[model samples]
Target: MAGQNLTTSIIIPANNEAIWISACLEAVLASERLEQAEILVVANGCTDNTVDIAERYVKLAEAKKWSMRVFDLQIGDKLHALNVGDRHATGDVRIYLDADVQVSNRVLHQIERALDREEAGWASGKLRMAAASRVSRAYGRFWSRVPFMAKSVPGSGLFAVNKAGRERWGDFPNIISDDMYVRLLFKPRERYGVPGTYVWPIAEGWRNLIKVRRRQNKGVEQIAERYGHLLKNEDKGAFDRKQIASVALAYPIGFFVYATVSLIVRFTKDQSGEAWSRGR
Candidate 1:
C-alpha cells in the first residue's frame, strides 16, 4: 500500500479547539494507510492553547513518516484558513478535517480507494453523531435517520477531494457553510460516499444545540442567496416525504425535540458575538 503513490494532505481549520485538537491529531498520527500523508492544522484566531497543543505533535508526525505543520492565523474566518492551508499543501489528495472530528484508521485508505478511480471527484465517509445528553441524543436519533444523513456523506465534519475534484472549484468562497458549498460543487455521480464512520458530536445542551442549528441554517440561507444555481446538485440524498414521515412516526419524541429546536432557532434573532460551539 505504501507503493500506491498517493500523497494525502489533511487540512484542519481550528478556532479555539484546544480541547479536541490533540485527540484529533492523535487519530491522524495513528492512521495505518496514511504513511505518506501531510497534515496541516490551521489555527485561526485562537485565544486558547490550540496552536501549542498542535505543535506538540510535530515530533510524532516526523516519527510516523508524515509531515505535520501548524499555521497560526489572526483572522477567524474558516474559509481563509482553508485557503492558507491549501496554498501550503502539496498533496494529490486533500482532506478537509474538522478539529473536533475523529475518523477511523481505515478512513484515509477508504478515501484514497474511492478517489483512485479516474471518474471520482469528491468523497467522504458516513457520519455518526456522538451525543450524551438527553436533548442531544433525541436530536441525533431523529437527525441520523433523515434520508440525506442516512445515505450521503454529509461532510459536515470530514470530507476529502482528489486533484481533479479540487479543480472543480478553486479557493473556497467566503461562506459559513464551507462543507455545503463544496458538496454542491459536484453532482451526486461525481462524488463517492465511502462505507465507514466518522464522529460528529452534537452540541450538549438544548441552548447549545439551538445555537449550532441557527448558525447552520444561516449558512444555508447565505449559500442560497449568493449561489442559487448550485442548489441544483444539492439534493444528493434529500429526504422524501415518505421517509420523513416514517422517521417521525418511529421516533416521535426525537422528532418533536428536533423540530422544536429548529423552530426556535428559525424565529429567534441571530445572536452576534456568539462563541463557536465545538460540541464539547
Candidate 2:
C-alpha cells in the first residue's frame, strides 16, 4: 500500500468455477502487494455457486478495507466478462488473473513494478501447471522458450497492464483468443515477460486439451481472415498450411496412440484376471 495513489484492479473472469474461486480470491487477498488493489469478479453464465463465493470475497474486501465488486453476465465468454468488469475498474493499473490460478505476493509486486516503469504497457510471467503431467510439462517447456508464439496475453491466469494501454487496445475482443488480440495491439517491446512471476494451474486433461487446441485453431483462422495482410507473406502462408496440416495430422496420430495404449492396458488387465483364476 506504499503506492496508494497507484491503485491496481485485479479482474477475474470465471464460468462454472465455484470450486476454485475461494482459493483464487484468498491468494489475491493474501498478497501483500495487492492488499490495496481492487478485486473484480466477473461471473459469466456460471451454473454453480461461483457467484456466492464471489460475494464472500466482497465481504472480506469490505472488512479488510480493500475494494471488491462482483459483476454477473448471462453470457459464457471470457472476453465478454473481462469487458464488463473493465467498466467498473477504478485502478490506474489493471491485472487479469484466471479463476483457477494462484499468484504470489512477490510476483504481484514484480507485476506492479514492471507496469510502473515508463514505456511499459503490459507485463506477464511464466505459467506453471500445478499438476505436472508429462504432456503439461512438455507444453510449458516449449512455450517458455517461444514467448512470441504465446500471442494471446493468456487469460489473466496472471498478467498486468497499464490503464492507458488497456484503453489504447480497448477491451478484450469477443474471441476465444482475446489475449493474443490484445498482445497484437501493442508493439513487442511494450510487453514484458518477467522471469520470477508465475501462476500454477491444474493440468488440462486430454479431452479438454483437444477442445482447447481446436478452439485455438479456430481462433488462428479467424485472425488470419481478419488480419492476414498484417502478417509477412511467407509467414502467413506457412501459418495457413500448418494449421490445416495440424488439424489433419495431430488429432489422428494422438487418437491412434491413445487407443493403442488403452487397448494394451485393457488386454494386460484381462490376462491378469484369467491368470489369477487359473492359479485359484
Candidate 3:
C-alpha cells in the first residue's frame, strides 16, 4: 500500500474563522499528496466571510482540476459541521483539519503513510503550537506531555481515519471536545500519533484561556456524568478523589496565583506611572 493511490477527503469545519481560513486552504492546496484528494469546507452558522473564503478556494480547486466541495449548514456546533462534511465525503480515507490550522505536505504524507498500514484505524500527528505567544507555548508544552490529555492528540485539530473507522464511530459526539469522545471509542493501539504533524498557533489571550479552561471543565463534568457507570468496578473513591484534587485544588490554586501576580504587577506599574506624572 506504499504507493497506492489513496483517495483522501479533507474536511475543514469553520464557524467565524475567516481571517485564517484562506491560509489554511492555501497550505492544503499546496500539498502534493493531497492534489488528487477532495477538499470540503463546511461553513456552519458563520456570520462572517468564512463562506466566501471557502468559495474562493473551491474555485481555485476546480481551476486546478482538484476535487472540492463547499457545504453550507445551519448547525452551530463543530460536531454537527463535521458530521455534515463526512456525509459528503467520497474518499477511502477521511482527514479532519481545523479551519485555522495549516499543515505541511511532509506531515500530510506521513499521515497518509500511516493510514496505508492495514491495522491503522486512526492516525494523528504531533501538535505544535506554531508561532505561539509565551503563555500559549507553555500551555502547548505542558499539554504535549500528558498521555491522557486527548487535546494533545492530533485528533484535536488534524486527524486521518479509514472509512471503516468512520463508519464504526458514526459521527463525532456532540460535545465541547468531540475528538476525545472519538478517541475513547477506539482501543488505544488503534490510534497512532505520527510525529512532525503540527497545527498553527492558537490565538490565545488571558480571557480566551480562562474560557477554554471553563469549557474543558464543563466537558469533563459531562463525560463523568455520562460515563460514571463504567467505573463501577474500579476504585471509584480514588478516582473521585484524584479528579476533585486536580480540578478543585490544583487548578484553582494555580489560577489564583497567576491572576494575583498579574494584577499586582499591573497595579505597581500604574502607581509608578502616577508618581512620575505627579513629579513632572
**For candidate 1, lDDT tens digit of each residue in 57-168?**
9999999888889999999988999999999999888899999988887887798778875553889988889998998999999998987787667888988988888888
Residue lDDT tens for model 3, 13-47: 98887888998999888776555588989988877
Clash list (residue pairs), candidate 3:
none
lDDT of 2 by residue, 1-280 (tens): 2334577888999888887889888877877755567889999988898998889878788777888988878998788899888888888788888888777656666677677754548777656545445554444444333333334334336767786577666666667556656655566567767654456553454433444444556676786788665333111112355553554364544334334434454453322222110000
Candidate 2, overall lDDT?
A: 0.64
- Give the TM-score (vs. native) of candidate 3: 0.74
Write the number of the candidate with greater lDDT, choosing between 1 and 3.
1
lDDT order of candidates, best first? 1, 3, 2
TM-score of 1: 0.93
Model 3, residue 124: displacement in angstroms?
Answer: 1.2
Candidates 2 and 3: which is better by TM-score? 3
Indicate whether candidate 1 or candidate 3 has the larger TM-score: 1
In angstroms, how far off is 138's CA in candidate 1? Answer: 0.9
RMSD of each: 2.2, 10.4, 9.5
